[model samples]
Target: MLVFLNQRLVVFSTPKCGSTALEQALAPMSDIVLQGDPRIKHCTFHRYKWRLEKFLQIFDDTPMATTALIRHPQDWLGSWYRYRHGSWLDGTPQSTKGLSFDQFVEAYLAEEQPAFAAVGSQARFLTHPKTGETVDFLYRYDAFDEFEGFLEARLERQFDLDRVNTSTEMRLSLSAHLAQRLETCCEGDYALYDSAHAPRPKSRMRAFMQALAS
Candidate 1:
């Protein structure tokens, strides 16, 4: 995660959502960069707001905004499957070595997921625990250019992001049953992604006041 104190912006890192590229590109400009552990570095919005932010009370009065990127649930799982299946993880318990994508997804949807299919949900990462509110800005992985443009304008700097931590390319296909199970189990992720692309609502009271004055 990268925090810009002057800008009052916090970029929450969502796993397998191009976070490495973002971190590499923005770390140099950030005031506080979390890099000690994967868990701390990729701290979720809920954790940051409830725990980390409170702990860092120096910035309590700062008007902060949060941002995150999310990918399609199936594609997110596919990335995890390919990454764990790589040669580097061949002998590890987390290795997806002998498993097909369908099998991996089945494990993912199981009540108790196998080590290889235990990646956490993106929707949960960006949401508030009690209120169910998401980040101030949520970007889709496929629409990164839009996110990049917004960041550039907000930070007053241009970014030339390099691709990092990319998994090997492979064609992934899910069985109908596995796909259905994934959709049912990860419905929140799909809903969050859809919400990210939706248009923001106008303030009805402001519009009403303006119309009355006119």
Candidate 2:
């Protein structure tokens, strides 16, 4: 999580999203920086809205312009699978050494997900559990240029993002059947991702209101 108090911008860290590179580039400009611990770094939108976002209102009491990136669901699980399959976690329960991507996703869809497949749900992370509100700005992970343009305009400085923390140990693909099942079961995940690409006239007004308030 990052807060640019002057800009009234809060950039949420969605796991397996390109947050590390953004943090490296934007940390110096942010008034408040939260990183290091995965939980803190990957703070959920709801947690921020209900807890920290409200707390920060003590300083500047207006709804902040928030932003987050979301990736395709199948690719997200692939990242988790490839990451845990690395040599570092070879012996741990979190290791995914022996499993194929299909099996890994199978475990993920299990009622009792094993440690290796316990990656948190992206929808839940970016949503208010009570009100079902998500971030103010949602962008597709693949279509990062649109977000970069927005940030450059907001921060008034052009910045380049470098690739970091990628999971390239192996390339794995999910079977078509399992992919369909994942899509069916994790409907919200797909919907959240789809929203990133949807037209957002309401969000533009929200951003306008935020600018006026600030």
Candidate 3:
């Protein structure tokens, strides 16, 4: 599960998965940008029109690490729902408006677009490119402490726990209805999630997810 990411990292951020916080954390380390396509907020492809490896190599040449924060599909779906429909009920600014989670998922299923697609998926980005080699490390946001520990040890630096734990709230609670709906709307992703064996609920995964979300 640990593959050395050619020394440079590219975090393939899925929307509303705490990618912003991670970008901020690593931002201080280098001048590189963590976004895939600025014009397309959620697009996986870049303006350069390169495949995975070519895009990856562009960053591999830099002194930066290409990394992104990913979250549990169930949790991420909720977050995406909130962000798209309105801001956090806690008073954060809303980013997008129009469409309920159900509606959006329906659109995604029907249109097969980026925002609607890739739910419950990690394999495409988490796996290797050439030899199908994955990254040196696939840090699970759910395993925050361990992941931070791994980073601290690797970089020989201490990270701020208070800052790291910012905005740690489950946007939506797990519900049977939501799960069933998600399974129906995102069948491919649901299956892929099972195949990937994404981390289950636990304090470790919770902490990691919090770090990435903030």
Candidate 1: list runs displaced more than 4 Å.
Answer: 198-214
* Winner by TM-score: 2
Give the runs in model 3 whose Cα sits over 4 Å from its true position: 1-12, 35-68, 87-100, 111-136, 161-178, 184-214
User: Residue-wise lDDT of candidate 1 within 136-177, one digit each (tens)?
Assistant: 988888878788887898899998988999998999999888
What would the per-residue lDDT of candidate 2 be over residues 1-214, giving only the tens digit for each residue? Answer: 8899988899998999898999999998899999999999999988897799878999889779999899999988888888898888999999998888899999999999999999989999999989999998899887787888888898889988999988866657778999999999999999999889543345778889989999
- Rank order by lDDT, top first? 2, 1, 3
The residue-by-residue lDDT of candidate 3 on 1-214, one tens digit each, is: 1113433444454455555555556546533354546333333423222454465566465443434345556665666555455345333333324545555455444545554333434444444434444444455556666656766665566656433313434344544665677677555444444443234456888789989999
Which pairs of residues collide in model 2?
none
TM-score of 1: 0.89
Error of 2 at 107 (Å): 0.2
RMSD of each: 8.9, 8.3, 7.8
**What lDDT score belongs to each candidate, Candidate 1 first?**
0.87, 0.89, 0.48
Best model number under lDDT: 2
